[model samples]
Structures are given as C-alpha cells and as structure tokens.
Target: MLEVADIFRAHGPTWRRTVSLSLGQLKVMSAIEQCRSAALGGHVLRCSGCARTEIAYNSCRNRHCPKCQGSAARRWLEARQADLLPVGYYHVVFTLPAAISAIAWHNKTVIYGLLFDIAAQTLRTIAADPRHLGAQIGATLVLHTWGSALTHHPHVHGIVPGGGLSSGGERWIACRPGFFLPVRVLSRLFRRRFLEALTDAHRRGQLQFFGEHAALADRATFAQWLAPLRTCEWFVYAKRPFAGPQAVLAYLSRYTHRVAISNQRLLAFDERGVTFRWKDYRATGRTRYKTMTLQASEFMRRFLLHVLPAGFHRIRHYGLLANPVRRDNLAKVRDLLHVAPRFDPPSDDTVIQAQPVFICRHCGAPMIVIDIVARTAPIRAPPMSRGAT
Candidate 1:
C-alpha cells in the first residue's frame, strides 16, 4: 500500500529545498520519512514456541504521522473508557467559516484554542439554560484541522452525553429522546461567542496576519473584517444521539487521533501524481466518493498544513469532565443516575498481569527481545566494566 511515508521519503528533500517551512513542519516531514526505517532503531526478537527470530523497527510516534496514530488513539481510548456514561451521546461539530479558517492558518494556537474554549462554553451554557436542559454538561472535544479533501477546514467534534446533572446536582436531567440540543440555538450562540472572543483576541494583540490579511492587524480594520461573520450563520451540526455508550467508543476510536489522511485512502502514486480517495461532501450519493490527484509536493504541503504548534493539545475535556474534577464529577453523576460506576479499582488481593510487548507473527506465542539495534551511525566502543583496569 502507498503510504504518506512513501511520498515524504521520495519528495520531502526536494520540497524542503524549494519551499520554506516552519521547524514543526520540517520535523513532521522528517519523522514521517524515517518512521519504521533503519534511520531510527529496532529490536531483534525470538519466538519461544517457533524459535524464529525477526526484527521489528520502532515507530516515529509523532502525533502528526499517519502511521503512528493507531496506537496513540488506542491508548487514549483506554484511558477514556471510564469516562463514558450509561446514557445516549450526541455528536456535535462546530466549524469556523472560510474567512476565519484563512486567518487561523497564521494564528493556529490562538484561534484553535479559542475554537475549543468557545465551543465547549456554547454547549455548556445552552444546556444550563432553564428553558433548555437546565443541567450542567460535560464534553470531550477533538480538534480536526483538515477536511476530507485536505483543505484547511478547522472544526471541533464534541461528544456530549444526552443529559447532565441538575443545576443543584441532585438528579440527572436527560434531554428529550432522540434529540440532545437544538442546532439553530447552538449555531447562533457559537457564532456570537466566537466573534466576540476573536474581537477580544484582536484587542489584546493575540492575533496575527500576513499577506492580504496584513491590514487586519489594525484594530479598526479587524473589527470591520469581523462584522459580516457576526450576522451570517455559523455552521453547527448536531447528529442524532448515538445508539449507546459502546457506539460512542467506536466513534472516538476513529476520530480522536486521526491524522490528515490515512494510508488506506491512498490509491496510487505514479508519474501522473499522487492519487487518493476523497469525499466531496457537497455532493450526495455515490458521487461523493471520488479520487483526487495532486503533485507530490502539493500533497505534502497540504498534509503539513495541519502540523499543530508544539505541545498544543488537539483533544480536550471540559465542564464536568475537566481533568481537575472528572473522577468526583463522574462519581456524583453515577449516583444521580443510579448506574454502577464503569471503572472499579482493583482490590489489593487482585493480581495484575502485564502483557508481552511483542508477539511473533509466524506463531501465536510471546516474543522476547534478543538484542537492541542502535540507530544507524558511527559505531562506538562499548563502555568498560566497572572493575576494568
């Protein structure tokens, strides 16, 4: 299968010389290019049953690398398993308009942070309204910076429970069956809050502009630029409640650690260009599934456009699910809902078993590391023993 790593390995050096890229983007390219290759390192393992030896290379483990996100997502989901509740869950998405997306390209950390905060605030504020659900809700928001076509479409996917604890925290208040919250209300509030926050960010000089948007650096020009976005509708979509808690887990396993594009989506990478499957969401039915070919350089460019600022988290929890009080909040919620706690601490008498780190492919048996392969480089003499003369 054609992988993003293949494209990066083939074209990254030339592309690096031709176009200017940020240190983060350059690091991402290098990581993807060298991932699982001899450039890193590997381990020699011997199967106990078959007595077969094999070499396994290490992964890059960069969050932006397409080949590395599966294990990352699985680890994240394992940590989040206890956070699930015994109620329906809703899938909501808050998308920034194209204009904002353009600006976000330059001010990713500021704007992306605002998107997460404002989206979570909108959901919580609406759910707490007396006329609405009138309860305090929790949400897990995952930031996705690219659309199916590899366009810079910034959005947050929010997974919210169908209900919340009452304002007084005495009882559970579930939303109407089959529906969680009104999309129209969420959209209006999201638009207003986001623009207001954007204006504040501008006032504080937290936003930046370049090229055609350079004029937006000025206060007056920036305010004028944001005027239309205040009135126009912002897209906020709310899907029907998930079938059950298990369904929500399935959804999270797919979306949480996804990179720009997966290796499975690549169709061909030949002289014509890099060909890949993409969904044209504007169309309906079978037409939506289509293939797109872009020059290798362009494909790498689009893929790197999503490399997040160093240390900026793409997945976050807010409100009741906030890290500070998640355990207590979950306990309270379970009591109010009369459901058993999903996670129970093991008693002292319970034995904990650790799984083997590596398994043999040829036989169903555990493999043990026989030797470590250092990264390719000049060989160094082994250190002398403690008693060496």
Candidate 2:
C-alpha cells in the first residue's frame, strides 16, 4: 500500500521548485504531517485485560487533511440523519461552460458563490412555475473543485427531493414518478441564470481577470465572449434517482467530507513525480484505471487551488432544508411519511466524554502506550500492542 509520505518522498522536492505555497496550504501540509503523533502531545493507553500498549496523539482536525475526513464524515452524517425525508431523492449536477471556468478559476470566491446562488434560484423558480411541477423544492448543494484526475473542475452536486410543496401549500406535488426535474430545462435555465449573475457582477466591477482573463476585463470583449454562450448548450446531468433514503444519505456522506483525493487511490510514487491511478471516463471497464504522472509542483499547485475562502461553506441548504425551517420541515416530513415521533433520550451521566481507542485490527485486543516519543529526539520504538490484533 502506498502512503502520502511515499509520494512526497518521491517527488516533494521537485514540486517545491515551481509550486508556489500559500501560507495557508503550507500550514495545512505541516499540520497533516504532524497530526496524531508524538510531535504534539500524546497519551498512553494500557489494556486492562492484558499488558497491551498503544500511543495516541492529538489529531490536527484540519478539514483539508485526508486522515481527518473520515471521522468528520461520520459526524456530519449523524447530523444529517434527522434531515432525511422518507422519499426518493435525486442527484443532479450543474456545471459551467469552459469559457466561464477560466474566470471562475481566477475569482473563485465570487464566481463559486454565484454558481450556487444562481443554480439554487433557477431550480426554485422553475419548480414553482405552475406550468412546471409548481412545488417548493428543497435541496442541498455540495461544491466539488476537482476532477477524478485532480484537475480543476468546479461543479455543484445537488440532492433534491423528488417532489415539493405546491404553490398553494395545500398538497404535495410529485414530479414525473421517478424523475425530479427535467434535465434539458435545467441546463438552459442554469446557463441563463449563471450568465445573468456573471453579467451583473461584471457590471458592478465585482469580477477580476488576470493573465488569460486580461482580454475579458474589457467590457466589449467580455460581452462578445458571453454573447456566444447565450445560445450554447450547458452541461447539466441528472443521475438516476436514489434507490431510497439510506442511499441518498450514503451518497451525500461521500461528497460532504471529500477532499481532492483519497489515500486508497494513490498507487505509487518515484523521482519522476507522483504516479496515481485515475479513472478515465472515456474508457470502459478494464482500461479505466489509468496512471498519470505530474510534476510535483504542479500537483501541489492543483491541490492548493481548491482551498476555499475561510468561512465559505462548501455545503449549503435551500428551501425546506434551509436552517430557519429545517426543524419544522423535518417534523412535517416525518409525519407525512408515517414515521414514529422522534424520541429524546436523557443524557448519559456516567459515560466518559472522550477516550482514545486504539485496538488491534486482527484480534480485537486493546493497545497500551508504554513509551512516549518526542519530535526532537528519536529513540527505540515500543513493542507492538498485545498480539497487535
């Protein structure tokens, strides 16, 4: 199995040459490398049943750290469980034209926000139209900034209800049985709404373009570039509706805490640069897992390009799922679904609030920490925890 350290050891120095490190990303990498080890403070755990030892260090808990996202996903899923509606859910993707993608890369904060805002607005407006479904839909939008190959591919993944409350709020209006929304209409509306927002931003001088965007900064040039997009078809894909509520939750769980890449996909690394397996969408079954090499600096640059602005939310809720009405909407949904009332449990007084658990994977025996290690000094490693299983 290849670890992140192996890849870095193989190509990190070369990447450092051309990859400009933002103060923020440099701090993130340093933190990830130091996390949950003796570089910080560590505590010893001893098994009561046997003389087993385990050493546990503090986790950096940075959102960008690949090691930390698993626990974060679990916690986020637990919270979202209450928000789940007992109905079929749809997964829709809204993407921008390549021409707009260039500007998006430069003005990530503004353009990304515009993408979310306009897409949400379009869906709500269209769904509420009497000629359409005429319902107030609820959705959660998740932003993903990378492709399977780790290239910059910004898009939004939406989890929307199969139906919504009618305009009169008297009855539930279901979409055409399995489908939640029309993809063709969604594409056109999404493109128009996005361009409208972009145009407004440009008029207000809220957008900035550099290098490639230099020509776009000119009013006439920008207008000319945007003019062709009005008639151009945008990409809006609708995945088959989820099998059930659990599937929806499971799917959302995967995207909610995902980073650029997971550890499992990393294959190997060497002086030539990092080589990792990526799925080629154009290829069929057997040839999908293709390996690609990137200059280390290029890899680092692509990785850091995705760090969102501080306090900007990558996951957002709209309509019923919006924070203000979430609790009430959830209760109503449960009632409509004939689910039992949610029960409140008394808080546990005797349960320990926090305890580090490091147990052997094979034998289910606990590990105890018999020795402590400091970053400044290296010494003998303690024996493996009792049977290490």
Candidate 3:
C-alpha cells in the first residue's frame, strides 16, 4: 500500500529545501521518514517453538505521523470506554466561516484554542437555558482543521450526551431520544461567541497578520473584515444519536486520532504526481467519491497545514467531564442511573506480562524477543544473567 511516508521519503529532502516550514512540520516530516526504519532500531524475534527468527522495527510514535496513531486510538478508546453513559450520545460540529478559517491558518494556536473554548461554552450555555435542554451537559470536543480535500476548514466535533444533570445535580434531564440541542440555536450562539472572542483577541493584539492579510493587524480593518461573519449564519451540525454507548465510542475513535490523510486512502504515486481518494462533500451520491492528484510539494504543504501548534491540545473535555473532577462526577452519575460505578482495578488483581505477543507466521508459534537493537549504539549480546533464565 502506498503511504504518506512513501511520498515523504521520496520527495521530502527536496521539498524541505524548497519550502519554509515550522519546526513542528520539519519534525513531523523527519519522523515519518525514519519511522519503522533501521535508523530507529528494532528487535530480533525468535519463535519459541518453531525456532524462526524475524526482525521488527520501532515506530517514531509521533502524534502527527499517519503510521503511528492506531495504538494511540486504541489505548484512548479503552480508557474512554469507562466514561460511557447509559444515555444517548449526539455528535455536533461547530465550524468557522471561510474568512475565519483563513485567519486561523496563520494564527492557529490562538484561533484554534478560541474555537474549542467558545464551542464548549456555546454547548454548555445553550443546554443550561430553561428554554433549551435546561441541564448541564458534558462534551468531548475534538478539533479537526482540515476538510476532506485538505482545505483550511476549522471545526470542533462535540460528542455530547443526549441530556445532562439538572443544574442542581439531583436528577438527569434527558434530551428527546433522537435529538439534542437545535442546530440553529447552536449555530447562532456559536457565531456570536466566537466573533466576540476573536474581536477581543484582535483588540489585545493576540492575533497576527501577514502576506495578504497584513491589513488585519489594524483593529479597524479587522473589525470590518469580521462584520459579514457576524451577520451570516454559521455552520453547526448535530447528527442523530448513536445507537448505543459502544457505537458512540466507535464513532469517536474515527475522528479523535485522524491525521490529515491516512495511508489507506492513497491510490498511486509516480512522476505524474500523487493520486489519492477524497470525498467531494459538495456533491451527492456516487459522484461524491473522487480522486485528486497533487504535485509532491503541494501534497506535503497540505499535509503540514495541520501540524498543530506546539503544546496545543486537539482533544478536550468540558462540563461534567471536566478533568479535575470528572471521575467523581462520573461516579455520581452512575449512582443516579443505578449502574455500578467503575473503579480502578486493584493492583494485585491484574497480572503484568512481558512476553512478546506476535506469532511466527510460518509455524503459528509465539515469538520471543532475543535481541533488542538500539538506534545509537552498537549491537550487544544479551546479559548472561538474563540469558540463563
């Protein structure tokens, strides 16, 4: 299968020399090139029963690398499985208008953080209103900055429970089984709050401007630029509730760890350029699936567009799932629902295994690691003390 790594490995050195990139993008490119290669080292595996030998390389394990997120998504889902509630789960998306998306391309750290904060605030505020859901809702917000075609589209996906605890925390208030907050309501309020926050950032000089957008550095010019967005309807979409809690987790897994593009989507690469499948969201039916080919440099540029700001978190929790007290809040909610509270396993209850889990392909016998190769050091024999075992 063709991969983002293949493209990077083939064209990265030339691309890096030609383009100006952030430290984060440089690091991501380097990591993808070296990932699972001999440069990063590996382990030599010996089948316990079949006496077969095989070598497996290590991963770069960088968050942005397309090849490195499967285990991460699995581990994250395992931990989140415990947080599932008996109630329905709704998927809501809050998206910025194109003008804002343009600004966000340059001011990622500031603008993206604002998106998450304001989007969360919008959900909580609306859900708490007596005329709306009238409860305190919880949401796991995942920030996706790229559209299917790698355009600069910034949006937050909110996985919200169909209902929330009453403000008093005494009883659960359930949303209608298939519905959560109204999309129009969420859109209107999200637009207002986000514009307001963005204006404040501009006033405080938190926003930066360059190239075609250098005029935005002026408060007056920026305010005028933001005027149309304030009046236009913002895009907020809420999907029907998931079939069950497990379905919700499955859905979350798809979006939470997604990179700009996945290896499975790439179709071909050659002198003609890189060909990949993408969904043209504007179209309907079978025509929606389309393949796009971009020059190697353009492809790399698009991929790097999503390198998150250093230390910025793409996933965040809000309301009842707030980090400081989420565990206690979840326990309290379980008690109300008459479900058993989830407790951490007792230290002695679980056994730790250090054995290699891979099986020998030829004989179907479990494989054991006999030699560990370090990337920066010469190969060494196993210690006599451990080998004696």
Candidate 4:
C-alpha cells in the first residue's frame, strides 16, 4: 500500500528545487512528508493486556493532507449530524463551462466566490418564484475544483431540502416526492447570475488574466470571450432524493472533506514516476478504470492545482441554513413540521476514563499512554530487535 507521504518524502525535495510553489503548497507538502513520522514527535502506547509496546507518531492534521483527514472528517460529520432535516434531501450540482475554467484557475478567489454566491442565489430565487417551488429553500454547497483525471473542473455540490418555507413563513411547502426544482430552470438562472457576477467583477478590476487570456484584461475582449457561454446550456443536475437524513449525512461525510486524490489510489513510485488509478466517466467497464503514470513533478503540479486561495471557504450554507439565522430557522421549520428537538444530552456527573488513541496490533488490547513526549526531546524509538507480540 503506497502512501502519499512516501511519494513526498522520496521526491518532494527534488520537486521543490525544480518548480516554484505557493506558501500553502509548500506547507501542505511539508505537512504530508512529516505526518505520522518521528519528526513531528509522538507518545509511546503500552498495551494493558499483552504488555506490548509501540511508538505512535503524531499526524500533521493538515486539511489538505490525505493521511490526516479521517479524524477531521469524523469530527465535522458529527457536528453536522444535528443539522440534518427529517425530509427528502436532493443533490444538486452546478458546473462551470470550460471557457470559464481557465479564468477561474488564475483568479480563483474572485471567480470561486462568485461561483458560490451566484449558485446559491439561483437556487433561492428560483425556489421563491411562484412558477417553481414557490418557497424559500436551504442548501449546503460544497466546492470541488478537480475532476477524476485531475483536471481543473469547477463544480458545486448542493445538498438541498426537497421543500422550503413559504414567503409568509406560515407553512412548509413541499415539492413533489423524488423531484425538486427543474434542472433547466436552475441551469439557466445559474448561467445568467454567474455571468452577471463575473462581468461585474471584471468591470471593477477584480479579475486578473495572464498568458493567452491576457487579452481578456480588455473589457471588449472579455465580453467577446463570455458571449458564447451566455446561451450555452450550463450543466445543472439534480440527483434522486436521499433515502433519509442518515443517507444525507453519509453522503456529506464522503464529499465534504475530499481532496483531489487519496492515498489509497496511489499504486507505486519509481524512477519512471508515480503510478495512480483514475476513473474515466466517458468510458465503461474495465476501460473506465485504468492507471496512469506521470513524472513525479507533473503529479505534484496537478495536485497543487487545487490548493484553494488562502482563507477561501470551500463549504457554505445558504437560504434557511445560512449561518446568521440557522438556529432560529431550523427551530421554526421543525416546529412547522412537528419534529421534536434533537440535541446533545447534558453531561453526567460520572467521571469518564480517558481512551487510548491506538490499540495493540497483536492482541487488540487497549494501549495506554505510559509517557509524554516533547518535540524538542530525542525521538523515543521502540527496541529494534523486539519480537512480534
């Protein structure tokens, strides 16, 4: 099983010398290389039942590191569990055309922000219209900027309730079962709103261009560039409703914290380069699942293409679920639907025992922390000749 850390530790230094990287990229590479290694420091875990000992290295805990997101994803999912609504949940996706993908790559913050804002606006406006659902909807929007082949494909995954509150806020208005708003309506609205927002940003000098797109710095050139996209059919899809609230949570767990690639997908690394698996949506059967080898440098470049702008939020909630009034809105909707309040229970007076972070591999027994480790001190390594316990 090849790990992302193995690739970085082996070739990262050479790649760093060859290609320039942003501060974020550098930090991400450093974090992945040092993750779960002696460099970051860790404590020793002694098994209570078997008397076996092991050294547990600490993780980098970087959001971008593939090895470090399991615990983070679990924590985030736990927090979102309470926010689930007991109603049909629809999965909506809004994707930008290839023409705009170039501009988005260079001006990620401005363009991506517009993408989030316009997509959310489209959903809210369409749902509020009497011709559509005629109600105010809430959605959790997650931004994904990469395709399976590691290309720059910007899209937003929206988790929306099948219904919304009426304009007067008096009652809940539910859409027909298994179907949400029309995709055509959402697509057209998203295209118009996104173009309007992008043009506004360009006019205000908020967008930047380079290389072949340098001509786009001119207003007329940019307008001409965006002309064809105005009428083209933007990709907007609505998947079938989730089975239940638990299904929604399960879906969120997988999508919300994903990176461009995971360690499991990595196959091997050698003088030739890195070999990894990729899925081709355009193909079928065995042909769809194939492996490709790229020069280590090229692989790193593709991975770094998705390093988002500093402090740019990739996950957002809008409409009824927006942060400003989420609690009050949830309460109101729950009351209208006659759903009972669900929350964390009060802490009991009983003293809880601290749990171990790792267990003994041999005996499956609890491994208690016997000593604390400080980073400045020497690495506490286990005996080199110890037999397998």
Clashes of each: 0, 12, 0, 0
Query: What are the TM-scores, per candidate, against the unseen true structure?
Result: 0.95, 0.87, 0.94, 0.92
Per-residue lDDT over 114-203 for candidate 1, one digit per residue giving the tens place of the 0 to 100 score: 999999999999999988899999999999999998999999999999899887888999999998988999999999999989998899
What would you estimate as the lDDT of candidate 1? 0.90
Candidate 3 residue lDDT tens string, 148-198: 887778999989888888989998888886888888988888898888999
Better of 1 and 4 by lDDT: 1
> Between candidates 2 and 4, which one is better according to lDDT?
4
lDDT of 2 by residue, 284-349 (tens): 998987888886666667776777776779999999789899887767666666685443444777
Stretches of model 1 off by over 4 angstroms after superposition? 377-389
Scanning candidate 1 in windows of ten residues, the lowest lDDT window is 377-386
Which parts of model 4 are misplaced by more than 4 Å?
Answer: 347-355, 376-389
Q: Candidate 2, overall lDDT?
A: 0.76
* Ranking, TM-score, top scorer first: 1, 3, 4, 2
| Each prediction's whole-model lDDT (CA) | 0.90, 0.76, 0.87, 0.86
Best by lDDT: 1
